[model samples]
Target: MYNGEKRRSSYLMLFIKNRIGTVLIFSVMPLILVSGIILYQFKASHYEKIHAHLGTLVKKHKQNIDSFLNEKLGDIHFIAEIYSFHELGNETFLKEKLETLQQAYGPVFVDLGVVNSHGVQVAYAGPFKLGKAVYSDADWFKEAMKREYVISDVFLGLRGLPHFIVAVRKSVNGDQWVLRATIDFAAFNDLVENIRIGETGFAFILNKEGDFQTKPLMDVIPEKGPYMDLLESDTKEEVQIVEKEDELSGNNIYVSAFLKNGDWLLVYQQKASDAFSAFTKALRVSVIIIILGSIGTIALAFVRFKNMAHHMEKAEHERRLMNEQIIETGKLAVVGELAAGVAHEINNPVAIMVEEAGWIEDLLEEEEFKESENIAEFRRALKQINTQGKRCKEITQKLLSFARKTDSKIQEVQINELIEEIITLSAQRAKFSNVTIGCQLQDGLPVIQGAHTELQQVLLNLINNALDAMEKGGGTIDIKTRLNKDHIVVEIADNGPGIASANLKRIFEPFFTTKPVGKGTGLGLSICYGIMKRLGGDIEVQSVIDKGTIFRINIPLKKYIGEKQDLIM
Candidate 1:
C-alpha cells in the first residue's frame, strides 16, 4: 500500500509539472501568433491606404489646376465673344479693345491675339507684331479648329521661351476664326513647382502624351519605364502604383492621377521612410512601454513570491523555536520546584547551624574559652558556614520566583525614597559592580499606587546591566522621577557604552541578553517588562551607540483602585 501511495504522489507531481508547462506555452503562444497576424494585417492595410490616399491627393491637385485653367480660359472666351460680335472684320480695333479687357484681368496673362481661319495672326497685343506669327500647326490651334476650344501643353514659344496657349474658335464677320491667348509658363512652373501635400510629398504635372509639362519637384526623376507606360496607357483612369527603386531613397511609391480634360497626370511621390516617420516613432515608444510593463509585472510577482516564501520560512523557524522554549521552560519549572522544596527542607538544618554558631560565638566570647587558640578558628568556620547557607537561600529564592506568577503589591510609594532604598540595598550586594548611581528625583512627587518591591527589582536589573556594561571604568547611572501630565515618569539612564544601536529596540525581549555565558539567565528585562505592564505602566528606551541609553517608565498617576481607600491603609 505504501508503494502504491508513493507511485500515486509521483504521478501527481509529474502531472502538475506537465500542466505548468502546458499553461506557459499556451499563454504565450497565442499572443505571439495573434501579434504576428495583427502586425502583418496592419502593415498590408497601412500600405494600401497610403497608396489610395496619395492617389486621392494627386487627383484633387490636378482638379484644382484644371479648374484654375478653365477659369483663366473663360475670361479669354468672354473677350473672344465680344470681339467676334462687336468688332467683326476689324483686327486693329479688336486688338485695342482686347488690351483694355486684358489689363482689367491683370498682368498674369501676357498676350492676346486673334487668328484667322487660314492660321494667319490677324490681331495681336502685348509686344508682338501682327502677321509675324501664325499658329495653324500648333496642337491647340489644330484641336480648337476641330473642337472649338482647347488648351495647349507647355512648349517653347516663338520668343524661345516656354509658354502655354489657349485657343477658341468663333465666327467673326460671318467667317470662322480662332482666338488665341499666350501665358508665361515660367509663372505656371513656379505654381506647379511649389505644390505639396505634406512635408515630404511632391507634385508635378504631366501632359496627355505622358510628357513632362513641368519638371517633377521630387529629388529623383520618376520611374519612366514599365510603370509609367502602364500609367500613360490608362491616362483616363486615375491609378496609383508603388514601386521599389534605388533611384529614390527608401520605399519609393509614386502616385499619379489624371485630369480627364487634358489627360494630364498630377503625380505625387512619397518615400515611406518620411511618410510613416511619426508612426514609427510612436510604435517604438509603445514597444518600450509594453516591455517595461511586462518586466514590472514579472518583478513584482517575483518579489511577492519571495516575500511569501520568507514569511513561511520565518513562521516555521519561530514554531520550532517556540517548541524548544516550551521544553526549556518545562525543565526550568522542574528545577524551580526542586529548588523551592530543597530550600524548605534545608531551612531547618541551616537554622540549626546558625543557632549553634551563635551559641559557639557566645561561648567563645566567655572567659572559660578565651584561652583556647582553636576557638577563634572554630568561630571563623561557623561564620563561613552561616554565610554559605544564606547565599544558598538567596539562590533558592530567585529560582522559585520563576515557578509562580508575579503579582505587584500596590502601595503609596515615595519616588525619591524608593530610589534611595534600591540604591542602599544594591550597594550592600557583592554582585553589584562599581557603577556610580545618582538621583535627580523631583521633590514633592505625588504619591502613586504601584508595586514598590517590583519597581525596585526593575531598577536593580537595569543598574546591574549598566554596571556589567561599564566593567572596570564605572559610568554614571542616573535615576529620575517626576510628574508629567497625568502620569508619573521614572527615567533610568546610563552613561556606559550604550546598548548597541541595533539591539536597543529588542532589549526587552525574553531570553535576549549580551551577558557572558553562565553570567545571566537573560530573563531580567523580560521580567521587568511584565512587572511594569501589570502595574499599568510601560517602558520605553532611547539609545545611541557609544553615547548613552535612557529608559523611561511611565505609570498613570490616577490608576483605578476601585472602592479601595485613597491612603495606603
Candidate 2:
C-alpha cells in the first residue's frame, strides 16, 4: 500500500513536471494579473471622475455667491454715482430709491444709509434709527474708506438679526461719503442652501478668518466639520476636493473654492459613502465579475486536469495488463514445451510396458503355469501390471493433449451438461475438504456457442478456487447457471473466509495470490479471465470479508462474430 501511494505521488509529480501543468499555471496567473490591473485602473478613474464632478459643483456655487455679492455692490455703486449727497439726504427720494432697488432685485437689502467721511450717519433710509448718528469706529466704515468698497461678514447689528453690510466709498468736491447697505443674511443663506451637492450635501461660506459668514447649511459648524483645516489654509488652488472622516458621519467628501473678492471660502460637503455610491456600486460589480471569471477559469482547468489524469491512469493500467499477459504467455509456452517433452519420452516406455504385461499374462494363461500353486497370485499380479501400464499411457496421452495447442473451435454446447461434468470432477476434492457442493443449473437452459475446452477451463478454475477458499472452514459451494436475455450467467459462490474487498479488483491480475507458500500458483484465475475475454465473455467477482465470495461468468448465447473471426484468422 505504501509503495502504491509512493508510485501515485511520483506520477503526480511527473504530471506537474510536464508542460501541461506549467501552461495551466501560466494561463491562470496572467488572467489574475490582468484582472487586478483592470480593477485598479477602474478605481482610479472612478475617483478621478468623482473629484472632477465635485470640483465643478463647488466652482458653480462659488460663481453664484460671487455674482450675488457683485450685483449688490453694483447696486450701491449705481446709487452713489447717480445721486448727489444732498439728493441722497432727501428722505423721500432715498426712500423711493430703496423701494425701487428692493422691487428690482427681491428684498436682499434691508436698508440704505449714507455715512459721511467723519464716519457719522448723515442720512439713512429704512429700519435702523441711525439718522444723524455720531461718528463711528466700525470696521466696515474703515475698510470702505481704505478699499473704496467693503462687504462685511454676517453679524448681529442694531436690529438684532444676522446681517452683513455692503458699503461703497464716494468722494465729491473733495469730501468723502460712504454709501452703505445692509443685506439680509437670510437671503445669502438661501443662495448657499439652494446649491446642492448630493443627498446630504450643502454649501456654506466661511469668512477670511474661517468663521461662519452665514448660518451653516449643514448641521456641523465650519470649526468642527471635516476638512476644516483645509478650509482655513491659504491654498493657492481655486478649487479643491478633500476627503476626511467626520466625527458623526464616519466619512465625508468636501469641495471648497476660495472667493478672492470676499476673502471667503465656499465649501460643499457630502458623506463619502453617498457621494461615491455609483463608483462603489460599479466596483462591486467589477469585483464580482472578476471573481466569477476566475472561478470559471479554474473550474475549466480542473476539468481538463481531471480528464487528462483519467486517461493517463487508464493507459498505465492497460500497459501493466499487457506486461502481465506477456509474462503469463511466456510461462505457458515453457510449461507446454516441458509437458510435450515429458509426455513424448514417457509414452514409448509405457507402450512397451503394456505389451510386456500382456505377454506375461498370455504365458501365465498357457498350460505350463495353469496348475501352479501360485497361479492365482501370478495372474492377479499380471492383471495389475497391465492395468497400471495402461493408466500410465493414459496419463501420458492426457499430458500430451494438454501441451498441444489447438485452434479455437466454436460449437453449440449445453452449459448445464458442461457444469455437471465440472462438478463431478470436483466432487472428490470437495468431499475430502469436508465442503458441501450444490448445483442449481436451470432446466432447459439455452445452448451457447463457444470453444468447449476454453469454457470448461474457465468453470473448472472457478470451482477449484471455491474449493480452495473453503478448505479450512469446510463451507458450502453453490454453482448456479441461468439464462437471461441473450446471455448465459454462471455464478460460483462459496461460504468461506472470503477475499478482502480491497483485493477483489486485483483477483484476476497475474501472479497475485492469497494462499500460503507452495500451496497454490496464482495464475489460474488470470488465465481463466483471459480465456473468457477472448471468447467474448466477462468475468466479475464480488466479495465481503468474513462472509463469502461470488464469481460471475457471463457469456453471450452467440459467439461474437468479430472475436471469433479474429481467433480463427
Candidate 3:
C-alpha cells in the first residue's frame, strides 16, 4: 500500500511536469500579458488625450487673457498717440473721451490720468478725486517711463479697491508725459471666474513672480501650488500641464499657460481623481476582467486535469483486462509450436516400442529358439518396451507442465532466472532463425513481485519478435538485467534493421507493426505494453535507423500486497 502511494505520487509529479507548463503558456500567460498591455495602452493614450485637450483649453483661455490685457494697453497707447499733453491737460475734453471709452468697452476702467514729466497728475477724470495728485515715486510711473508702456498686477489703489494700471509714455517736444488708466479688478477677475472645468475646477491668474494677479477663486491654496516653480523658473515653454497636491484636494491637475504680454500665468486646476473619473472607471473594469480571467483559467485547467486523470484511470483498467486476454492467446500460440516438438520427441519412443515388439515377434517365429532363450528374448523385449513407455510419459509430462496456467498468482521472482526460462522456450526458434542469443544477467539482483506466468509470456513474445527481426541478416540478441533504484530493469536489444522514427511512437499501439502482412500479427508490443502496465511496471522502446532497437522493461521490486491479494481472490 505504501508503494502504491509512492507510485501515485510519482504519477502526479509526472502529470504536473508535463501539463502545468502548457496550461500556463497557452491559457494563463496570454491572458495576463494581453490584459497588461491593454491597461498600459489605455492609461498612456487616455492621459495623453486628456492633457492634450486641457492644453487646448488653456491655450484658448490664454489667448482671451492676453487679448484682454493687450486691448487695455492699446487703449492707453491710442490715447497717448492721439492726444498731446497740452490737450490732455484740458479736463473737459479728457473726461468726455474717457466716458466714451468706458461706454464702448464695458465698465472696466475706473479712471484715466495724464501725468506730466514733473510727475504731477495734470488731468484726471472719473472716480478718484486726486485733482492734482503728485505723480512721482510710483512704481507704475517709473515702469512706464522706462518701457513706454506697462500693465501692472492687482493692487490697492487710491480708491482703496483692487485695481491695475495700464499706462503708456509718450515723448512730446522732447518732454516725457504718461497717459494712464486704472482698470477695475472685478473686471479682471470676471474674465476667469465664470470659466468652469469640472465640479472642482477653477482658473486663476498669477504674475511673473508667482503672486496672485486676480482674486483667487479658492479660499485656501496648497503650500506648494502647481506650476509655482515654473512661474518662477526660466522655463521657455509657454504652456504645460502640472501635477501637484492641494490643501482641499489630495492630488491636483493644473494646465498653465504664460501670457507674454502681461508676464502673467493662466492656470486651470482640478482634482486629478475627478478629472480622470472615466479613466478610473475603465481601469476598474480592466482589473476586474483580468481577475475573472485568471480565476476562469485556473478553473478550466483544474477541470481538464480531473477529466484527463479519470479517463486515464479508466483506460488503464481496460488495458489490463485486454492484456490478460492477449497473454492467454500468446500462450496458446507458444503451446501449438511446442506441440510439434513434443510430438517429434514422443515419436522416437514410439518407434523404439514398435522395434521392440517386432523383435519379440521375430524371435517367437524363429524355429531354432529354445524355451529358455525365447523367454529371455521376450523378457528383454518387454523391458525395452517399458523403458520406452516411461520415456514417452516423461515427454508428455513436460508438455503438460509447459501448458499449465496459473491466473495472476503473485510471487517473488528472480528476474535473471525468469529470463533464462524464456530463453529456453525460444531457443528452438532462435536456432532455426540463425540468431545468437546472449544474456548479461546481474548477479544477486533484487527479486520482483508479479505474476510469473504473465511475465514469462511477455518475455517470450519479445524474444520471438527479436529473433524474427534478425532472421534475414543473422544478428546477436543481447538480454541484459540490472537493479535500478527500487526496480529491476531488463533490456532486450537486437542488431536488426531498426524502426523508422515516424513509426516508432505507434509501435506500442494495437495493430501497428513494421513487419510484412503474413509474417506477423501486430499485437506483440501492444500486449507487452499492457502487461507491463498491469504488473505496475513500464516498457519503453528506443531505436536508431539501420542500427538496432532496444526494448526496456522496468518492474518494481515490491508490489502492493493488498492489490496482489485482491487479484488472487
TM-score of 2: 0.64
Cα lDDT for residue 537, model 3? 83
The C-alpha RMSD of each candidate to the native structure, in angstroms, is 12.4, 8.8, 17.1
Per-candidate TM equals 0.50, 0.64, 0.51
Model 1 residue 49 CA deviation in Å: 20
| Alpha-carbon deviation at 271 in model 3, angstroms | 3.7
How well does candidate 3 match the true structure in TM-score terms?
Answer: 0.51
Best by lDDT: 2
Give the higher-lDDT candidate: 2 or 3. Answer: 2
Can you write out model 1's per-residue Cα lDDT over 1-569, one digit (the tens) per residue? Answer: 34534764565555455554554455545554665566667667776777677767666677777776787788778777765533633656766755775567555577777777778776676666645477778777788888877788888867777778877789756777877778767666766676675667776777755667777665544354333654556445666665655543656566766653636766666666666665566556656655675556545654554555557656765686466545644554454455546756787887788788788888788887888879768878988988977865665455444333455577887767877888787674414466777888888888777778877887888777777777766677888888899888988888877776446545655546788765775667766765565566767676656677888888777663444321111
Cα error of candidate 3 at position 357, Å:
53
| Candidate 3 minimal-lDDT segment of 10 residues | 560-569
User: Candidate 1, residue 197: CA error in Å?
Assistant: 11
lDDT of 3 by residue, 1-569 (tens): 34544786678667755786788788878887998898889888988988888888888888888888889889878888988888888888889879988998879887889898878999999877889987687778888888987888777756677788999999878999898998878887988886677787888888876778876677535337755675765666667788877665689888888885538888888888878878889888988987898778777876787678768866885686467546644654454345535655777778777677767767766666645645776767677777767666655543333333225677888889999988888888888898889999999997788878778878988888888888898888999998899888999999998777567656765546778874554667755765676677878777776688998899988784444321111
